[model samples]
Target: MTTHPTGTREDWLKARLDLLKAEKELTRRSDEMAQRRQALPWVKVDKAYRFETEDGPATLADLFRGRSQLLVYHYMFGPDYTAGCATCSTIADGFNGFAVHLAHHGVMLSAVSRAPLAKIQAYKKRMGWTFPWASSSGGDFNFDFNVSFTEAQQRDGGIEYNYQREPAWTAQGIGDTMTKRGEGPVAENADMTGTDVATYTRERPGMSAFVREDGVVYHTYSAFARGLDGLWGMYQWLDRAPLGRNESGTWWRRHDEYERQA
Candidate 1:
């Protein structure tokens, strides 16, 4: 009655054992990549970046919170948006649980966005998330980190993200130059955030790492696009599922949205 391949227990075990060998090799390669990532040189951060926190104004170094290291998730909540990006929100849901463990290990984790502090706080409360989220409103932190862009940049082909120059959205078939078809992941995500494609695409999702030593902060690492796959906890579980991701299109929502849909 099933469409999938039928196998006896012995057949299943043999196939699973072969998969286990590949899985172990992948794990070994992952470990080697982490070592190489750690060996990358740290770049000194000379700019004085500031942020608005629940406790008040804070600097990039203050985000470490007496720890030597800081991890910032570049959440895509542009100032004009009424809400956070649905995908970023899903990734952040895992943060509330592990942030405490990281703090105990001498590393502080926080999320930074260009939205105002008040907006961030309202959304945080709505999501019931207690993890540290900060506001970089009116600051160049997001732009400097290459996660936020301006309209001119979008139109003039000046935007660069994921470590490469991006073709201007104007030149693309979507955004302002094209009619809204209300289709595809980008358009759907733009609708979810209550913004046009141009505005939604202006902000990207990524993570950055910093370390403070001898009273100076240095940028250690950053990852964008698919590079962030490891941090999306749900995907790790889905990868082990029988159907393995089973994705067709934008199939996820903010965790709370599912409750409303139900």
Candidate 2:
């Protein structure tokens, strides 16, 4: 009565064993890639970037919090948005648990966004998240990192993200183009954030790594798009599920929004 392949226990074990070999090889490759990432050269940060934290104004170095390393999640919360990106929010949910562990291990983790400090605080409280969140409002940090873009940049195709040039977002089709018949992930995400596709897309989600050496901050690494797959905790578990990701369009929501959907 099932559509899936039927197999005896012996058959299942044989297939699973074959998969185990591939999985192990993937794990080994992942370890090698991590080493390569650590080997990448770091670029010195000379600009004096500032942020607004709950504790008041702070510099990029202060984000390390006495630690030598800092990991910033470039959260997609533009100033105009009423809420955070659902996908980014989901990724951040995992941060609250591991941030303390990172802090103990000489690494401080925080999330930076273009939204104002007050808006960030209200949303942080609503989500019950205690992890450090900072506001880079009126700051060029996001733009310098290629995670935030202006309307002119969007129209001129001046946006370069994920290490490549992105196509210009035309003003005429801004809203219509992003929403594919008012469906799919982008449109759904835009609706969730209470913004049109143009505004929602002005901000991007990514993570950046930095290290403070001898009182100077250096950029170590950055990842975007699919490069961030490893940090999405739920996806790791889903990969081991019977149906794997089993995705179609936008099938996820902010953890709290699920209750309302039901």
Candidate 3:
């Protein structure tokens, strides 16, 4: 027998109707937020950022592939990471499906990582993703966007992420634990990426938007942390399920990690 609460049909209907009103209110608020996002002013980008794509070198504008708008997912695959971050990999698993559709609709979707081109290509192939991915290795693109931090920045805790300054992990008492898992988010994902906590943390996950108009590219918007919840395909589905996310810590891994499911 299930442990969930049971009730009469009329009782269930009453509860569901109440939830439906709240759901509609949430939907309206979400629509308002979308309008606000669209109304935000676009800041012109002057930096000459370059990236290494599968097809030779390309500029940030080139990633749009003739589209007027571009979306870049800041994947957390640092230069020294042996593998991609598990959480990022899971988030990206849904991209290949919608990327083609987005391109057709005048928007381009791609991923940018601090890893080398070869590493990014290998991981993309392993994950069977056909979307365009670029490498920002040896470039200041990630750091300038506040998605990456230097050792000095991490040590001093003077970096801004998710629109606020966060204390350095070291200052927060996050020790380097290469072999330990389940200690915390930093340690767990660090182990999954086959790197130390600090190295894995140097790169953070985010998404940035750009718009090209009349030979100029403008930075339109960016979102970090839970701001990206809408873009995460899995969570959208889970939110509608009876039990919701039902998460207790990180209970997910790279799609390929569960070989038995394959």
* Residue 47 accuracy (lDDT) in model 3: 95
Cα misplacement distance, residue 197 of candidate 2 (Å): 0.3
Best by lDDT: 2
Which segments of model 1 are wrong by more than 4 Å? 171-182
Q: Enumerate clash totals for all models, in the order shown.
A: 0, 0, 0
- 11-48: candidate 1 lDDT, tens digit per residue: 99999999999999999999999999889999999989
Weakest lDDT window of 10 consecutive positions for candidate 3? 173-182
Please state the error at residue 2 of candidate 2 in Å: 1.3
The pairs that clash in candidate 2 are none
Query: How much does candidate 2 score in TM-score?
Result: 0.96
Off by over 4 Å in 3: 171-182, 260-262
**Candidate ranking (lDDT, best to worst):** 2, 1, 3
Candidate 3, 218-261: lDDT as tens digits:
99999998888888899999988989999875677889888753
lDDT of all predictions: 0.90, 0.92, 0.88
RMSD of each: 2.3, 1.9, 2.8
Give the TM-score comparing model 1 with the true structure, all chains together: 0.95
